[model samples]
Target: MLDAPSSSPRLALVSEDPLARGALARALSDQAEAWTVVAAGTQEELEAARGEPPDVVLWDTGLRLEEGAAPDLGAPVLALVADEAAGELALGAGARGLLFRDVAPGMLGAALHAVARGLTVFEPGLSHVRAAPRSTAPSGAPGPDTLTPREREVLGLLAEGLSNKAIADRLAISEHTAKFHVNAVLAKLGVQRRTEAVVRAARMGLVTL
Candidate 1:
């Protein structure tokens, strides 16, 4: 399917588990017919399947790479991880997007297509790992030190693992406004994902988790 140029984008699914590799391939073929899907059960199969390279590589967390360096493959990568911490590791390994292992089929297809189009996505509900270093605000740490009172509230709610809708209901704010506050909190905390913001808050002694 990857041999020639065509309208549909080519994608490679890499996983050690035969079931996972098969399921993802079936989902892409069934839900995302616009994509030409290929499956690889091992690294050797993955390398062999890459004749000209596909538009994207959806790889399982089992794959590892040195920090700050990407896979030699020319295509962008979307990693499947067990949790947000694993997701962060994958990103550091140069994956452009992350999908949790239990993601729904529709989301899996959509995430793949979006990453193929050059977007970096982290699945909702997967936040930063708490094992990150603690923050030391010596009367001044520009990033986490700058969160406003409202943003701090949002961060607290985020730490509670509340979705935007739940946060809005609790605070009696519109969902759009809740989303805005959440994004603002993330920006001030210097974290990319919601869970990361919560972790940062805990590290900074800003939230009692």
Candidate 2:
């Protein structure tokens, strides 16, 4: 009952364990009819599914990326990790949202809905996402650099490794308009390259990865 439209808001369900994958799939399948899922047991399957351009992916953080793979789906990626540390690792690795593996089945839908709308999700108490990093700031570093709340939303998609084109699609802006925000981000971070900016912005607590 799923159509593979190149522009549809399809979802890719990714997990290594059959039971976990099946369970997550069942949880997502319960959402409204527009949400489609492509089950992927491996990163290879994940990347292949991305060619169809799903709007969001429900990923288990344990899936390994092939060397030189972008290391994540270019679309919104919601990671189901084992703990807050695992969530941090996934975020640092370019995931856009994190949920505990034991997230309430209802929460699973809410989190996916949020991620698809280009919003971040954090489990409670585990919700350290809004706070700028607390680790001691590196000498001469600007930890806790704050962005206008608007820029924060832009940066959230940037952390996902999306080209301005992809980000514009998610945020409903023209590519030229998105490029303007990106240039603004580059100037603010004093960095080149999307990955470098994300690493540094997150490291310095300027932005939550």
Candidate 3:
């Protein structure tokens, strides 16, 4: 266990395999900024070590949902699964987010932050999994189904936490054009921030994280 400043959001990494848990913790620690990696172990050990609930719990489910049950970690849980079936199972088990085991460290960090803030996250691979029905879009706002193909592409990049320049490079378009598409996606989703748009898109089954 490592001590982190109280101001930094605390993340608990839970996995059944010690080797896998250590590797994930190290990766997360390497990219940590807004949050800190606190402990890696079972939920009970994490709670006992900190003597308080973490802001978020990143549970690495490996190839299966252990014992076919999601633990109540006394905090939001972001599940790291191996495949879409396990991802769906984790969601059904009440996990706030479902990411694949091969997720990049940066994307995993973003999902942890999002889930900690009470937003649901899904891996792009799980886009085919239909999410539960959500409330209709805001009045005068275009639904997710109405986003243009390019705008939808921008939305997916946003879900990956890409900046305007990064998106431009990825799409081989002008930065200004990428910015324009980002704004369009935000407006259509009726959200002001990239994270919000990602959340809305995921809930609408338009895009995943």
Best by TM-score: 3
Estimate every model's Cα lDDT from 0 to 1: 0.69, 0.65, 0.75
Question: Residue by residue across 14-63, what tens digits does model 2's lDDT show?
Answer: 66577878877777667563566744665545655556666788877544
* lDDT per residue as tens, model 3, 49-128: 65467798899887655223454557899988888777777776568888889899988888887888888888888767
* Per-residue C-alpha lDDT of model 1 across residues 11-48, encoded as one tens digit per residue: 77766678878877777777635667644655446654
Which pairs, if any, clash in model 1?
A: 127-195, 128-195, 128-196
TM-score of model number 1? 0.52
- Candidate 2, after superposition: displacement of residue 10 in Å? 1.3
Deviation in angstroms for 120 in model 3?
Answer: 0.4
Q: State every prediction's TM-score relative to the real structure.
A: 0.52, 0.51, 0.55
Among residues 3 or more apart in sequence or in different chains, the pairs in candidate 2 whose N, CA or C atoms overlap within 3 Å are none
lDDT ranking from best to worst?
Answer: 3, 1, 2
Evaluation by lDDT, superior candidate among 2 and 3 = 3
